[model samples]
Target: MQNKLYLDQRSNAFIILNLLMLWGWWMLYQLYALPVHYAKPYFALDKIPLYLEWSHLWFTTWLFVLLCICYLCTCLLLPHLQVAQVSVRWTLILSILGAGILNVMIYPVGAVDLFYYLTQIKLFAYYGENPYLTTFWPTYAHDELTPLSSFLSWPLVYGPAWLGLASLPIKFVGFDDLLTMLLAYKLFSLYCLLGCAWLIFKLLGGGAPGWYGAYVFAANPLVLFEAVANAHNDILLTLILLVALLGLRHRHILALPAFALAALVKVFILPLALGFAVALWRTRWPFRRIVGGSLCSLLIVFLLVAPFWGDGSIIERMQAAVEQQQTLRTAAPISLANEYAQTSGASAQQLEQLRIVFTASYGCLVLLALFFVRPLEHAMASIMLLLFLLVSSLFPWYLIPVFALLALHPRRLELGYMVVASLTGLLYYPLGVVAWQTEGLTLFQIQLVGATLLALPIVVFLVALLFQRRVELDQ
Candidate 1:
């Protein structure tokens, strides 16, 4: 009886901890987050400033660091605080409630990428302009609401499916009010993320591990901040990718269109589809059926994306992607390499050569993973990790899919996920943009930070690998 009572007490404590964490997150957002244009037009909470002063920005940055530490600590605490089997459903329920509450808060706390999304949706919804062909820069002069157009003035970098899905808010809510549009977009993102969590729970068979995984993702500070507060479309992209992977497991025909749609959202997942397709083809399934299913999937994808196609716009889109990649050397290893060369007084030609080598090498690594990695899940995780490590720019939210993948098998990648997610938040330093613009942080310093953030997990992973190999050898 005492032992049962002890377990009950622990379960109650766990429930309390979950609610406390949710409330803590709410407080942090209310007190520390910088104001963005998304909420500036709507409800103004007097406690929160309309814009961040220098002191507030600095405080917010430090508070963000503290919150990340708290987040990781909570994750570590959860395993020991498991609730009763009956209470398992409460985990997902509270997570949904927390997400909804945060979404309704209407403040763009951690990121400004939502503005870029807003601009993209507005371009298509209001002006009837092709986002792929027309740059937002031309429209910026006339639309005062579309702030930060200068930062993302390039042509459409996202895929057609993402463009279509993300633009739904503007269609229904209309772009006349920033607050309404922001709310609609965030609510949609909330729905997508919940869908992802649900699928994860279902895929994991609703066991203890599955429930824990669902809660881990559903309540993760990064997920709540990125998926709810900042409202990144990567959440939607990851959802579709997960659907495709699940379909592949079940041998469902939707796998093809799902994969195609995922590619249309991000385009990075397309290669993984090729890799998994090869695996599927090698299965005992009939060759003709496989071929027919593949053709039908492709046909549906083409039909869905056909409306966005224009005469000779593919080349334009490709050029835009290349140019954008070339300009962005923010958080990836290639960026570090280029910064190293520049600091060493290398010429433009030398930097260009370095870019070519790194880019090609990155491509080769991805292709190898696509071809060699077995089991579609492992292949997807490998490719996503490669992208996270190699991409020229980085954001904490970019790791959402990675964390989702890691939820399946948490033993190996858990430490790496925690490290990357927490450290990447350091990129949210106050005045980072100003520092970069004014060269306050020299090229070498920025490179050093980026390198550290990328290298830590990699070093840990390598060390773990070597240790495992040594254990096997000894055995």
Candidate 2:
């Protein structure tokens, strides 16, 4: 009876904390209205007074910490709680759904990538232009949504599958209504987020582990912030990846085509698909079955890209998009290295050489890990982590796949690392904001802080691993 009471109290506390976090987000939405233009004046960082800036920072920090606490509590409480109970199951479902809806209402104050997503879909849907081949600049300079898009000159960086799916809401809402379109995208993302959570729950076989996995993906603050609040397309990619994983387990042949479709959402998953193909070959599937699956996968990819192929070479356009993405030097170790190089008067050629080396090294590491890592999900998680660590353009939402994969195979070390990473990944934004605004702070100093944030999770993971090994040896 006492234990049951304790569980109820903890459950109630979890519900209240989530409500508080949602309220905080609502308040934040009101505090910082959507920007007229998504640029340097983002979140009105420059125009806002020092007090308001500090207030936003403090509020955001508190919410982040509170979110971490809630997630940690969920991790603890899930193991003991009886998810078999109807009320318990419904509570989990309703809480996730409620939080997602509230997040849809909140403006994407963290990043304006959603606007870019809208612009690309609008370009394709309304303007009769191929998003993959066309840039949304000089041509659509006066368009209402153009000013809001950060990537005005770059071609669509995402794959055709996402573009096609995202276009539906824009088509329904139409271009005349900007606010509605934004809401539509938010709603679309919320649905995808919910889909991911549901899929995770189903994949884990609907017990304690199922509930735990679902909560880990859905209740996570970072996932909510990026997937719903910011409305990133990573949620869509994650959903498709989960579908692919489900198919891989049930109908082996279905996995290939599903993975192909997933890669169409984001090319990063292509490596995993390749690894899957290799795994299939190693398993010694019949030659005819292998050929049939390969053909089906190819057909899916071809059909998805065919509509947007236009007159330009799709391969060339894809390469250009990849290059454009690489040019972005966000909160990654390479970004820090580039910053230091610039401050120290290092040559551009030298930096390029270093980048080449890093890229090649990462590619090799991924190949080896794919070959060696047992089980498909572990390989996916490991590769995603490698991408986060090695890539130059690191964003918080990129960790979405990591969280999704961890849901399937929740190892202690990776799970703990990712939970910590979600926090540190978010810290980059506020730290960058303060570092940039503070006078006399060097660019190198700013990048150094980002590098430190990037490194902290890895350091913690390593230390924990070492301690675990020591404990096992002592025993």
Candidate 3:
């Protein structure tokens, strides 16, 4: 009886832990706004502070829990249920329609990037200038520039394809009406969501398990909440990357076009795209195939960027972009440097020195890791590089690509990604302001805690894999 009690306790604990993660994701979506559990006599969620200010935060948290439960129920019922007897393609169509309408309802509350996005678009559309350079439009239209623009430019600097897309909603919906504009933006992202879902469903029919990819991809706390709700443009790039991978999977040379589109949308992703290209070359495909692909991609990138570069030589535009990208201190890639400097108490020059070394080292390591694994499992390895970038950051939205892939490919080791990403993302019920402050942690303390939290389990998984050799023979 005692042993039975202990077993039940352990099971319940894990369930609770999963519930916490789901709730956290929901709260992130709600920003704690809708008290999803408000009417319940007995709530399954941890109650947020009753103060109106804390309301949105906790409410969203509860909603995340509810969504997870629904998804969990979906899973539990799968074995006994004949729901999947429906055709794969048809199931996807239903999901897109269901998920799309639900996302639209919560769309307003989902967006945190809206203000910055709107401001930047206005600067570009109305001012006839590169918005990345202008920082922010002057409040007076002829007055002093916004100090805020200097930092916000990082997310604003997408390629012309994105710039054109951003302007579309405002064109039809009137930027003066913030609500309509926001909805239009949501609709644009919605298209990407539906496309990604449809692709995942197609893959599952081909062989991949729906449990690993579909459940997590469509309903994962991270992807649904952050990508759909928050309206992050990263989803657009992620879908393109997924489409590229899917094309590659089918041995369609069309992967190059998809890869090119992704690269043109976001320059930072070119290295990742290039890595995938190299992996593709090792296959039976002729060498000239990718050479043609590369030229075409380069042409597209140049044509779109030509307006910005035509005023000066290619060298000049490249230099300007370098200057422009330096302006933001928040978010991944940059924030890693920002935090490193803040914690080190280093001068600007020292920080710059560290930045160069880290970038070079990171790039070399990434290439080495890519080459090492790329040859082993070309598709899986290339996707792993993207995962490396997604988790190595603090922002909630970076997981868009990982989650989308999870839906389509579904790996078991995602348990590692899930544990880490949950700490900062999907299961991300961020520490309360008081809980965070009261901890009074230094940078070193922060690193220690975070590393232990994320790494310990991953190390365990690695160890268990080694013992699996013995377990296999015993079986």
Top candidate when judged by TM-score against the true structure? 2
lDDT of 1 by residue, 1-475 (tens): 9877776775665666666656656665566343344444322222235334555555555555655665565456556654445674575477557745665564665556677788878888787888887777866557855544335567878887898888886689887877677678888888888888888877777766676677667666666777777788889988987787677767777777788788778776665665666658666556675777679778877786677677868557856765676566565666677777877899999887887786686688767666554345555666666665665455567767766766665553564555455545444334343344454677667656655664456446534534554576679
Cα RMSD of all models vs. native, in order, equals 4.1, 3.2, 7.9
- Candidate closest to the true structure, highest lDDT: 2
TM-score of decoy 2: 0.90
Q: Give the runs in model 1 whose Cα sits over 4 Å from its true position.
A: 32-70, 73-84, 103-106, 281-285, 363-376, 412-416, 423-440, 462-475
How much is 399 displaced in model 1, in angstroms? 0.6
**Candidate 1: TM-score?**
0.85
lDDT per residue (tens digit) for residues 1-475 in model 2: 9988988887676566666666656665665544332333233333445435487677766667776766666666666777776766777777788778777876676788888888888888899998777788878988887666677788788888898899998898888877788888999999999899889989999778888888888988789888998898999999988887786666467677878888888887666766676667666766776677779989988888888777657778878988888767666676667767877888989988878877887798678667666556766666766666676467788888878987786667766776788787766667767877789977778767776776557546645644654676679
Ordering by TM-score: 2, 1, 3
Candidate 3 per-residue lDDT, tens place, 381-411, comes to: 3343333333233345655665565445333
Lowest-sum lDDT 10-residue window in model 1: 41-50
True-structure lDDT of candidate 1: 0.65
- Candidate 1 backbone clash number: 0
lDDT of 1 at 351: 80
Off by over 4 Å in 2: 32-41, 44-53, 281-286, 371-375, 458-475
* Clash number for each model: 0, 0, 12
